[model samples]
Target: MRLSLTPLGVLLGAIFSTAVLAQDSDTTTITDYDVISAPALSSDRIKSEVLIEVTTVGTRLIAVGAHGNIIWKEGDDWQQAEVDTSVLLTSIAFADEQNGWATGHHGVIIKSEDGGKSWKRQLDGFELMTLEEGYFENRIEKLNEQLESTDDEDVIGELEWQLEEAQFQVSNIEAAREEGPSKPFLDLYVKDSQTVLAIGAYGTFLKTEDGGESWQVISGRLENPGGYHLNTIFGRGDDLYIVGEAGLAFASYDGGENWETLDSPYRGSLFGGHLDAEGRVWVYGLRGNAFVSDDKGQNFTTVDTGTRVNLSAGTNTNKGTQLIVGHSGTILEIDDQLEVKNRTHPSGSVMTDIIEVAEGEWIMTGRSGLLHWPAKITEEEALATQQGAQ
Candidate 1:
């Protein structure tokens, strides 16, 4: 499970750092949320909700979310980075100290080479509008072929009716396709400094070499065969893994050239996965299910997380491996032995990302912008204090 980096890996790491150092200040601000239109949903209006994801570049801690919001921690205070475009950002990743990337809906991929001070859109799927048009044309052709093959009068009548419905749907699809792939990027991973992989809804998976300069669609069905939405992508060395709805998991060994589905232990949506230095892989998802794979995901053993709230992201820290900021801002800490040592609530805000800033001090962000220097109390410690008070 623990694979040593080759000399190439070290070289790539250095190059990534160099890219970061070369980043320029291109930060923009979110002056007004009204500028960005809310998503249109049939059942309800798409209210802009704050979604948070955290990562470190050098010593800097960065969290990004809806409306192109980027917050970075400097010593004690957190400052918002000025980002252009009011698109909803879902995830961010750093290639090195200064170079990073943030992705969101509407084919938005913003890159920052000098830390996160500035950002520029690298690639937009607006060009893919043609693909959507072609999709509808193909559907119409298939329906016409079916109608011609039917012979019975009643069957012909039914087929004609279905054909009319198909044409109507296709027309709608054509209109939307003309708008482009508004799917956005849900999760992203930097496989060293040169390679990056991004995944999102509608089985969208994109990969880029030479940093974020160019991108191409990799392996994924237009509509996932399993009908599950992909939530996140994780990479170690040349191996890549993705998890999403319905306990679905997939792996790519040859740098994402080919992918094969893997058996998952549960049947719920997985939010994310992390690989520790010890080579152990941990994945958490819906309804408080946490599974540990000691053998690089060949097998798994379920761990008791003690809560049903969905977990978004987790990482290993000095305090121990922590599952931070999930449903309702729930924070769960697992010690070196993989035991749940403590759980605490720092805020009523739903936590999207958590990072240990210094020793016991941590920083967590969610829908309510950035919170600085949150307190971390172990579960046993909190319990003893409560008992004494009684």
Candidate 2:
């Protein structure tokens, strides 16, 4: 029986959680191996590890995955980077050839300066909790002052409600401090060296304008009241797009200063998104579901991908082609004419992310680790390489 990747999020989460919890011993508990302070263990087998996200900085290929593993390739061999944390890194983005950022489990945001060679943790869940606590505390104080000064019933009612919400959030943060940082940052958008957006599960939205020296909680900027998991954030120009669990989508025309929720067609979680040069918005997720919006995400039409495998990640090739990769090694291509072609790898590996190496060539990473796509060789070519000893 073939495993379906329609709901890849739940499947991967279970695998990671089980691995972390199984580290119990006589003298040490699972907490002893806290991902927050633990550095990624050095291993020769990192090339075959379950990598989740891949991207390119110039000619260098970098990928991050389970156990906080981050690897980069420039020539023949892939070299593991010096990472500071062992949390599961889910998304990575580079603003230039020399600067990049990655986000992962435990609300981690790590930055790499000299290409992708080494990374330093800039933010994490513990720090995020503190930031939230302070923000809400300040909000509650301001709201209380407004309530005491206002005489109008309508204004007083609004102030009271805002104060209540802020206080509630503070209480939640205080409680979460005991459990440690559990939320994972699912995706990231690097605007520049100084400004970046890291979003994740449960409407975890954050921004750092001073290059991660200080981060601000910006989840309230979005209209996500239920705090649904934010799965992906990507855009082109000033038009930004965010898609997540329950088919939730948001668009920001003027950068991320403000957001408006878009009406998504599919009700399942959207795992990835792409914004084209022509301003077309493509969002895809569970069950091979994908939609394109030409009018800034106001309305969308389905793109018939001809497959039911979940689409995990996508990219716009340097040659102007659109590609989406997913479970079972499926690859869907959208040409300039909007024609969709779907192809699957013979190995049937679960591909989590893909990036264009050149015009026709590509590199992808996932459960089977990192490898160049179209990896299979013809039978004749294979037979010729297999010399018999007799």
- Please, what is the TM-score per model? 0.71, 0.85
Q: Write the per-residue lDDT of candidate 1 for residues 301-324, one digit (tens) a residue.
A: 888888887777777777457554
State candidate 2's TM-score: 0.85
What does the lDDT come to for candidate 2? Answer: 0.78
lDDT of 1 at 329: 53
lDDT (0 to 1) per candidate: 0.62, 0.78
Sequence-dependent TM-score of model 1: 0.71
The residue ranges of model 1 lying beyond 4 angstroms of the native Cα positions read 1-51, 128-173, 178-181, 221-223, 376-390
lDDT of 2 by residue, 1-390 (tens): 112212323443543211221121012222333776688888898876678888878888899987788999899888999999887788899888999999987778899999999999998888888887887788888888888887999999878866776776777677667656666788899888888998986677999899888899898888876667788899875889999888999999887999998999898888889987677899898888988888989999898888887788888887777999887768888987778988876546677788887777887877656756667544454235323211
